[model samples]
Target: MKQFTISQEHISTYPNPIILKKGEEVYYGKEDTEFPNWIFCKSISTRKSGWVPKQILSTPNNSGIAKVTKDYSAHELTVNQGQTVFGIENLNEWTYCKTQNGEFGWIPSYCLSST
Candidate 1:
């Protein structure tokens, strides 16, 4: 496994219990669905925040961006494995969003993998 760094200072400010920093990676899941697989990839940017996944409001992580509630398709959204989303808005509750290019559509929260 590769070494990664996580922060805890911003956890209290997130809409959820977790607060992801600008460049950190962390695994997010609960119970039987813990660890290894089923991870959501996330990255924090200096964009505005208003709504995200309601589920994340309670289970926030300090090292990954909160998951969104949109459906993502390669034909709809132009996202690769290592691309970062820089136009997200209203990330306090579950809200679907399209990329700046309009190629990508809403990205469901469960499909994201951080780290």
Candidate 2:
């Protein structure tokens, strides 16, 4: 049982995404990964799917990346306040990241700081 903490806020579209903030705790799901420094995870209470950084996770490797969620659906993510995200792919302005609830979407880069 590993716990992950959010360093900042991450907002995603509801019904398909998640919103997490600093001081929040997340549950590590699978270690098998899709990208380096990224791990599959879920929100402790809401059960949202997303990806978190390996450095921030309690264990180095203990999560799995869900490919279905990584489809890079609608641009519904807004990274803010020094949030750390497992970057799967990146575009010029938007970045594909796993949501805390296991969803992938495009998020802005202005508000992110690598952990």
Candidate 3:
């Protein structure tokens, strides 16, 4: 695990995140213009939608259906400046982190610094 300090405050936009399992099918949607390599996807099983890193998604067919290449949770943690977190995974410029309070979610890499 890597330790990091939150350099800037980050608020999670999505409360109910989309959780996906490996080999699960999803409906691919538009890519985020502000964040490159992140795309909006709707899970076929739960019908929940969230931004997912493109790295974990398999190539989509013409109809925009794709398989998840790995298990992923789209949860985002609301962090404040000066807080510390442990990074669990890094993908598409975002870091999945665990807070001292036992909360886990994703935060933008730019908002964190190595501690």
Alpha-carbon shift of residue 27 in model 1 (angstroms): 39
| Model 3 spans with C-alpha error above 4 angstroms | none
Clashes of 3: 0
lDDT of 1 by residue, 1-115 (tens): 1111111111112322223432232333332233222234333442332222333323445754344334322122324444433334323221134434543233333333333
Q: How close is candidate 1 to the true structure, as a TM-score?
A: 0.21
What TM-score against the true fold does each predicted structure earn?
A: 0.21, 0.36, 0.94
Candidate 2 per-residue lDDT over residues 58-99, each given as its tens digit = 542344322222222334555565444566765554456775
lDDT of 3 at 111: 99
Model 2: lowest-lDDT 10 consecutive positions: 64-73
Which ranking of candidates, highest TM-score first?
A: 3, 2, 1
lDDT score for residue 11 of model 2:
70
How do all the candidates rank in terms of lDDT, highest first?
3, 2, 1
Clashes of each: 30, 10, 0
Question: Which of the two candidates, 1 or 2, achieves a greater lDDT against the reference?
Answer: 2
Which scores greater on lDDT, model 2 or model 3?
3
Choose the strongest candidate by lDDT.
3
